[model samples]
Target chain A: MAVTDEAIEKIKGMIVSGALRPGDRLPKESELASELGLSRNSLREAVRALSLIRILDVRQGDGTYVTSLDPQLLLEAMSFVVDFHRDDTVLEFLAVRRILEPAATAMAASRISEQQIDALSAQLDKLGDSPSVEELVACDLDFHRGIVQSSGNSVLCSLLDGLSGPTTRARIWRGLTQEDAVSRTLHEHRAILAALRDRDGEAARSWATVHIASVEQWLRSTL
Target chain B: MAVTDEAIEKIKGMIVSGALRPGDRLPKESELASELGLSRNSLREAVRALSLIRILDVRQGDGTYVTSLDPQLLLEAMSFVVDFHRDDTVLEFLAVRRILEPAATAMAASRISEQQIDALSAQLDKLGDSPSVEELVACDLDFHRGIVQSSGNSVLCSLLDGLSGPTTRARIWRGLTQEDAVSRTLHEHRAILAALRDRDGEAARSWATVHIASVEQWLRSTL
Candidate 1:
């Protein structure tokens, strides 16, 4: 292994083995370097790498500490990774989303509070009809995010959030070229909300599926 | 942004914008650092961080280059992140897997070949009636992974692989403690394979669901 990678794995061993619990500040650089038998430079590089992935937090003028290691935080690194996906793979990403979002929506159906449903409904109403492509894209992200959050599974919420990156551009393009796409999206959102309001998991799931499937179908034809 | 973060974002922008295509060698460190207006140290740290996530490949003697950025390679980093998940969150991870693995199984039913089915059946038969906990755990991973791979979505396959980390220990615990767990798992695997053989997507999906739900149920009761 490379020196830096070795340094990284040692630190990871500490975290995973519970030697360094979340929010625990590290020992001084010199002490840790000696303790791990790594050079200071290799240790610094490893810390930088871990921080990039949200595994560590390097406070200015303070010691480095482990983050909460929450699924949401850890998986946020995935959105960064997903941004680099090739165009050919966007459909695959969308297909995965098609599987996940509907399940999340269905889960939300059983657990989503009436107030949460109203909040979602209000967010849609605030968008009104005939919004700009940018507005629609932003609302679309928030709309699904709100619903997925209700699924009560942080891992699911984070995975769906991470997987949405590649499809964002597809949504913008669809909204721009497909003239009726805006109205169709709004209509679908309302249908999904209605299903959630009625606590109909199957209906919510089906609506979510077709909603993403339409985007996938449109992108497929265009591609 | 921190200097290293700015440096990382600049490199990421290059890749995402098509300037730094996959497998493209990065410019000489000094020259690229000057062009990007970054100090050598920041650039190096950024390269190290990006390489840690499989975004950039650093050759010891050769120049650093962009990786394939394949979803599989990119999301492999997620498995690393998934390792840090807390005990309380294992159920959330399992819930996401339950949603994904079933869909992947259903997809596989339509696309999996007779040859692949034979391979899976052969794998099961090789495990024999009695096996060690380690063997059971390894076979269980390969079994679901084989089915998910047949699902024909690399993103889905990678995400499922990443999400399996937390549940791995859970599987081992179930295998070791529950007397019927091993037999039950073997039976379920056969049922899943039979569904695939018959090309019954719904049946395949249900078997996959119950397969995971049983593990979830066991883990829930234990927890």
Candidate 2:
């Protein structure tokens, strides 16, 4: 494991130092091993591990290459690990989302097109007053995602995407057991939508903070 | 690779569904492979990959087990991936930090201990007026990290830590070549420290935004 880790660092160092670049094919396994002063097996293990994380691409007979290293591809590993987090970890993710979502909302306020705002409104309309836990959870995810995507920062979008996964289950659990979960969430979404429609960044930010905080507050009291 | 990915998902599904939990030992290799309906070889590959990301722990002779799934541990994978990001990706990270650091500084303002504020003051003092590029870079990281840590959210701290890595290099480059880099950053740190000392979340937040924005602005113009 240590040898493989070292090899991984060497390969990553090459990327950081601009010796290897995105989409560049790596040298043959044997040659890279010698260049990095590692045994071929360790190098192969390192490559495999990195490939698993979407950092490297192993195309079978075509040879290994550096991935595009796009924020979406690299942060995919985060979504995987997020699934493993216990319920307790949700609070930490929420703390982060509280800071990010409101800021993202503010950015979106000025940038979101009329079409997008209409789509958001249409989305809320699709969720009637009394939706099931599953339906509510799906709508909730889409609503928050729509606003964050409008922020125009892919990294923020990806980070929030990863953070939102475990909480979606929590939201479902809340929707099933908590009183007025459906109506309360829908109401908050309506408030946030109005702010966005007004192109009021401050109001949008405030509404978003209030919206997510309501969920956090509920989680706190219930937990 | 596809088979290994499937095996990875199966193992992750177990964790997510609470069939397997943090620090839980797996059944012996053969039994676990059978349980997941995976070949032993594929299971081993999956485990190796997970271990690389700190999601699983592989003991030399002891059996493999799920790791604690701590935020710090899981997010370590992020730092590794962040290293592979292209120069343009730094902008995305900066955008995130711009949102997060201000919020984090605000949280820190009310919560930061007097001792911590003093420590930040001392940190700034150590940089002096004309520190070297390397010194300025290191101080710059520690200064921001100190405020974020005071926010008391490990996830936010880790995310910011990972985002700061490549930008540290950029800072060093700028410090070496740009005019008055050292004095400007030091002056900003002093302003943030003063706000933190006053327990003024709004001021702390504003100062943090200005401090980070200066760097972002520099990167925008230069990059």
Candidate 3:
């Protein structure tokens, strides 16, 4: 095994076994290198890798500490990769989201708080008056995110968020400029909010399915 | 932004803009460092981060190269994070698989080739006679993977496969020691195959929905 990889694994082991909990600070570079039996150069490589995944939070002039280890935070690393995908991959991702978001909505139906439903409705209302492509993109993300957050499935919410990143949203927004995508988007959001308010799992699932399917259909014909 | 992050974005930009093609060999570290206006040490950090996500393939004695950039390959990195979840997170992931795999199965109904079905059948046949727990787990992955690949959506296949990784599978396998799981699993696999062979998209979806939900029910009960 490479010395640097060994250090990465050793540090991961410490975190996994609970020796290094979230928010714990690491030793100084010199001492950590000595303890891990690696040179400072190799240890730096290990730290760099971990930091990229949000496992280790590094700040200039500040000590490195373990991150919160939340699924949402760790999975944010995926956004970088998602940004690199090209045109067809965006629709492909939306198709998968068509499957996931609806399922997540259905799960949220039973448990979505009244406050959460009102919040989503208000976001929809705020989005109703006027929306540019950029505003539509932001609104679309928040509307979906609000429901997924209420699903009580942190990993599901994180993975879904990680998969549909800003770059893809921009592409969709660019495509959505043909018509009043703002109205369509708000309409879909309202339908989903109504389902949640009714506490109807199947209705919520169906609404989300139709909503995303419309977007997917529009994206397909545009391509 | 940090020099390392800028280097990462520059490299990714090159790829996204088609300046770098999939499977293209990257410039030597020294050359790439000079081009990006960063020192070798800084560039190494960028490379390590990309490599972790399978975007860059680094060879020890050889120069670094761009990966195939296949969605399947990139999504594999999620397994590294998936390795850490130890609680109800497993169920959350499975719920995602429950949505995706069935939808993929339904898509496969139209596109799946005769040869593809045969391969899947053969894979199931190998597990027909009550395989060990390890064997069962491997078969389970292969069964779902086969269906997803046939869906003709590489992004969806990769996302579903990455979300339902082996680590989560191992946990479910460890807990499914009862003899009932043996027959129930085989039964479900057969039913799904039957639906596929019949070219019944709805049936395939329904069967898979029931199949995974059974396991999900078991998991929820235990939780």
Candidate no. 1 TM-score: 0.95
Please name the candidate that would achieve the greatest TM-score relative to the true structure: 1
Per-residue CA lDDT of candidate 2, range B1-223, in tens?
3777888888888887888888999887788888878777667768878988898898877898999888878887787777777777788888898989999999999889999999879877776566667777777778888888889998888888887874555543563465566567678899999999999999999999998888888778878
- Which of the two, 1 or 2, has more TM-score? 1
Tell me the deviation in Å of residue A114 in model 1.
Answer: 1.7
Return the top candidate by lDDT: 1
RMSD of each: 1.8, 3.0, 2.3
As for TM-score, the candidate ahead, 2 or 3, is 3
Name model 3 segments beyond 4 Å from true.
B128-130
List model 1's recovered fraction of native interface contacts, to 2 decimals.
0.83
Positional deviation of A190 in candidate 2, in angstroms?
Answer: 2.3
The candidate maximizing DockQ is 1
How big is the positional error of residue B77 in model 3, measured in Å on the Cα after superposition?
0.7
TM-score of each: 0.95, 0.89, 0.92
Q: Which model, 2 or 3, shows the larger lDDT? A: 3
